[model samples]
Target: MGWRRSRSSEPHADLRLLIERFGWAVEHVRVPRRSTGTPSSYTVGLTAAGHPEIVVLGLPAPVAQDFLNAVAEQVRAGGSYRPGQRTGEFTDEDGPVVFLRVEDTGGLASARDVYGSVEALQLVWPDSTGRLPWQPGYRNAPGVQPLLGQVP
Candidate 1:
């Protein structure tokens, strides 16, 4: 199927097209260090495929894109996940990553605008020393990887 650009003022025609073709689309937001927040990326359209959308914080745009893409692929292939679960599918070298329910959707404006009240999860990765953000001596700053949901 092909996507026709709608006349609405929404500027996500490209995102819609990508979702139609690939089951999901990744959106990477890069904020300068001087800004209030670090870089983040999220998936759009996963809700349409019967899966909750995903978000990754504090990673570079390219890395986040690849990570989200891999997750989307697995979800589309009948894989299931839940908040507080750990998996090594994405980063086996760094050990398993944790998934948490995103209680706040304010940062996922694109997914909300497209799907309207969609469920989302945060894929939290660990530091180089295999310590999660909640653990002591984690490398990144607090603001660098803000959690939008409760710790599981």
Candidate 2:
């Protein structure tokens, strides 16, 4: 059976089905370039499956969704990530992706709203030159990738 819809009119029925079948669901958020924030995506229901929810910042909505899905798939397959861990499993033209522990969940309101007080990680990808945002020669603008946690 489907869960009751929330006041915000989110697709609880669809999300429920997804979580039941896939162990989690990805929520892609697309923010306009002119907006104060950049595009991001996060996972829902991962905590229930014994894994921390995941988030990726500064990517296009589709790419972010795909990345989150890949991470979720790996998690379901028994792969795990920790803060400051770097893995080549998910990579761009530049290099491996890094995982950062989300010390603050304020930016993940949607994921929190779905699963209260869930632990989360941010998947940080490198720039064209394989430089992370904190490293020199990083390509993206400062606002493009707002880190939700401290750089490890």
Query: Which candidate has the top score in TM-score?
Result: 1
The TM-score between candidate 1 and the true structure equals 0.89
Model 1's lDDT to the true fold? 0.84
* TM-scores for the candidates: 0.89, 0.87
Model 1, position 53, has a per-residue lDDT of: 97
* Count of residue pairs whose backbone atoms collide, per candidate: 0, 0
RMSD of each: 3.9, 4.0
* Candidate 1 ranges beyond 4 A from true positions: 1-10
Error of 1 at 64 (Å): 0.4
Model 1, span 44-115: residue lDDT tens: 988998888999998887788888888888999998789999998888566578899999888888898898
Poorest stretch of ten by lDDT in candidate 2: 1-10
Q: Give candidate 2 misplaced runs (Cα > 4 Å).
A: 1-10, 92-94
Name the best candidate (by lDDT).
1
Clashing pairs in 2: none
